[model samples]
Target: VLSFGLAGAASQLLGDMAHRLIPVTDREAASLVRSIRTAPLLFGWRGSTPVDTPALEELLLRVSRLVDDHPEVVAVTLEPVVVAPHGVSVLGA
Candidate 1:
C-alpha cells in the first residue's frame, strides 16, 4: 500500500492537487484523484491506457488506515508511483 502525505502540484508547476487528513475513506480517495489537475493522465491520455483507479483508491485507503493505526507516523511520501492498466508500482517511498 503505497501513498503520500498529501499530493503536491508536482514541483508546483504541473497543476494543483487535493488533500485530506489521515483516515481518508474510499470516497475521499476517489475524490482526491478527481481533484488533481493531471488526473486525466490516470484515466488515459493520448493513446495511453488507463490505470486501475480502484486499486489506487484502495492503496490510499490502506495508507490512511496505517496512519490511523500508528501514532508515531507523522508523514509519508511515496514519489513516482507508477500506475499501469495491469498494476501499480511504488518507485520510491
Candidate 2:
C-alpha cells in the first residue's frame, strides 16, 4: 500500500491511500505517488522549492521491496514524512 495526505491530515482521509500486490513495480509506485491530491505541494506550489519527488518515489519502491522480501511484514507506514527540496525525512515508521 502507498498512503499519504496533507502534512497534518488523518490517515483515513479520503483520497490518501492506495493498495497493490507485493513486489510493486516502478510504474505502479509512480502512479501511486502521482495520485496524491496534494501533489502540487511537492512541485513548488506558491514559489516554494519543489520537494524531491523522485526521491519520494524511490522510498515507495524500497517499501515495496521490503514487503516482497519479507512475507511476515503485512504493512508499512511512514508518518509525518517531511519532504524537503532535496530529500525526505521519515519521522515515524
Candidate 3:
C-alpha cells in the first residue's frame, strides 16, 4: 500500500491541513478536506463554483501510491494545483 501524508495548500497563515502516515482511505480523504481552514473555497464560497474535491483526493491517493512504488523518490512537490468545478490542473511540480 501507498505511504502518504498531507497533500494540499497547507500554510499556517493561509490555512490548515490534515495528515496521515500512509494508505489513506476515502473516509480519511474526506476528513482531510474538512480539516482545512480554507475548505470553504473547495465547497464554493460566495459566487465561486465548488471545486472537484474528489479529483483532488484521487490525485493525492495516486501521488501517495507513486511515492510508495518508487523508493528512489525521496521527495515530491506539486505546487499550485489549480482546481475548478469541472477539473483540476497542475500548474507546477
Candidate 4:
C-alpha cells in the first residue's frame, strides 16, 4: 500500500476538487498516487482482473481536495486500492 504524511498550514479547496494534484513532491508522484485511489489490487494483473482507475481517481480527488481544503487534517493513512474481478473496494479511507 502507498502511504504518505502531509505537513502544512491550513488551506481549502473551496471549489471543484474533482481535479487536483494530491499531496506529493512532484507531478509524477501525484499521477501515481492518484491512480490507485479507487480500490485495492489483488495479486493478479494478467489474467486475474482489471482495476477501476477512474473510480479510484475520483475517490482520491475528493479526499485530496478535502485534505487540501481543511488544514485541521494533519495527516491521513489509507489502505491500498483493492481490485476484484466483480468490483473494486477501498479497505480504508
lDDT of 3 by residue, 1-93 (tens): 332222444655443546665557677767776676677777878878888989888877777777777788877777668877877787887
List pairs with backbone clashes in candidate 2: none
Error of 4 at 21 (Å): 5.6
Return the clash pairs for model 3, or none.
Answer: 4-22
Model 3: per-residue Cα lDDT at residue 13: 41
| lDDT at residue 34 of model 3 (Cα atoms) | 67
Q: Candidate 4, which segments miss by more than 4 Å at Cα?
A: 1-30, 33-44, 85-87
The order by descending TM-score is 1, 2, 3, 4
Estimate the TM-score of every prediction: 0.80, 0.80, 0.77, 0.47
Candidate 1 Cα outliers beyond 4 Å, as residue runs: 1-11
Q: How accurate locally is residue 86 in candidate 3, as Cα lDDT from 0 to 100?
A: 76
Candidate 2, TM-score vs. the true structure? 0.80
lDDT of 4 by residue, 1-93 (tens): 224222123212222112334443344334654443231232244566655555544555556666777878867656554644455576775
Model 1 quality (TM-score): 0.80
Predictions in order: lDDT:
0.72, 0.74, 0.68, 0.45
The local distance difference test score of model 2 is: 0.74
Candidate 2 lDDT score at position 27: 88
**In terms of lDDT, which candidate is strongest?**
2
Query: Regarding lDDT, does 1 or 4 come out ahead?
Result: 1
Candidate 2 residue runs with Cα over 4 Å from true position: 10-15
In candidate 4, the residue pairs with backbone N, CA or C atoms under 3 Å apart (3 or more residues apart, or in different chains) clash, namely 12-69, 38-56, 39-81, 39-82, 40-81, 40-82, 40-83, 41-81, 41-82
